[model samples]
Target: MTESKDVNAGSTASKERVAQFNQRFDFGSYAETRQFLDELAELSKRDDYYPDVSFGKTYANISIDGEGQAALREMNSTFIADMQALVTKTKN
Candidate 1:
């Protein structure tokens, strides 16, 4: 995949045409990042929804597809909020 040189996430092949929400988080260590990813996986399993996830030792990038539907957009928002909570939990 091509790296996004634009901070706004604009790139030649960056799924710009897709209606999706994206976020990236930085963690203190590999263990913390792994825990966050694990929690996200569990949440996805319980909700029966999965988002595109990419991660490294201390960071994670999440992309939730909404497909331009209101219901799906709302769900994505909630999922993001829930994931944020998990981040907080992992921090502590």
Candidate 2:
């Protein structure tokens, strides 16, 4: 999967047009990053929508690519929103 510098996520139409969800985030610390990854792992298990996650130090790069376009689009939105929530939660 390719890394995207564009932080502005496209609309649902763009998600439908693409076959993958790619985004990068910074969690500020190793511990915070680990917490974020743990949350993601649990989410993947619960939703059965696994993603490609790479991280080091304080940054994480995530990508999910597979079959089922509809499911993928939904998962993309869900995952991104949850991740954003996690970031907000951690900040507070």
Candidate 3:
């Protein structure tokens, strides 16, 4: 699949969009996951980026692309990278 760039998120907003998302969003062990949330918030603020944040008691999701399913078609790589980093860290 062709990767999208310069779509909605620049090169910076990916984490902001992702970080703000996972903050209030639930993920099971809320206490242990504090570091992850802090990392996301720091990355987002540092990069000066913010995405559509959806918060719920049980779950939440973030969108770095434009909006809806179509925007996701053109996902910025930075978002994926950041997410991967988080995943890798958790996995280890």
Candidate 4:
């Protein structure tokens, strides 16, 4: 089975939520946000888990994942901790 599978079995029991994120980073005004998005994109690339991205004046709904969300919490908690560490903002 793929390491990407069934991870939710070991994750949080929170109901699925639509969220947004904004934050401060190690650079200019919105640099952290950009870095957050860039790193998220990079992580998605590595795991073949791309999400939708929408840019706006003050925020971006940079999807962290898609339909396969049942296991997202698990993936981030375990297999993709590196990716989890990079995201410092979330909206719900």
RMSD of each: 5.7, 7.2, 10.7, 10.5
> How do the residues 1-92 of candidate 3 rate in per-residue lDDT, one tens digit apiece?
12446674576465335332232334555443554556666656655565555544434455554332233334432653574477447535
Q: Cα deviation of 21 in candidate 2 (Å)?
A: 2.2
Candidate 2: tens digits of C-alpha lDDT, residues 1-92: 44444554454446546556667888778988888888888777777776777889999898765444367576564755776687778656
Which digits, one per residue and each the tens of the lDDT, describe model 4 over residues 61-84?
Answer: 543432345455646533245544
The residue ranges of model 3 lying beyond 4 angstroms of the native Cα positions read 1-28, 55-60, 67-77
| Candidate 3 clashes between residue pairs 3 or more apart in a chain or in different chains | 17-51
Worst lDDT run of 10 residues, candidate 3, spans 15-24
TM-score: the better of candidates 3 and 4: 3
lDDT of each: 0.75, 0.70, 0.49, 0.49
At residue 8, give the lDDT of candidate 1: 60
Colliding pairs, model 2: none
TM-score of each: 0.69, 0.65, 0.44, 0.42
Any runs in candidate 2 off by more than 4 Å, and if so which?
Answer: 1-19, 66-69, 73-77
Residue 58's lDDT within candidate 3 is 38
The local lDDT score (0 to 100) that residue 32 gets in candidate 4 is 60
TM-score-better candidate, 1 vs 4: 1
> lDDT at 71 for candidate 2?
75
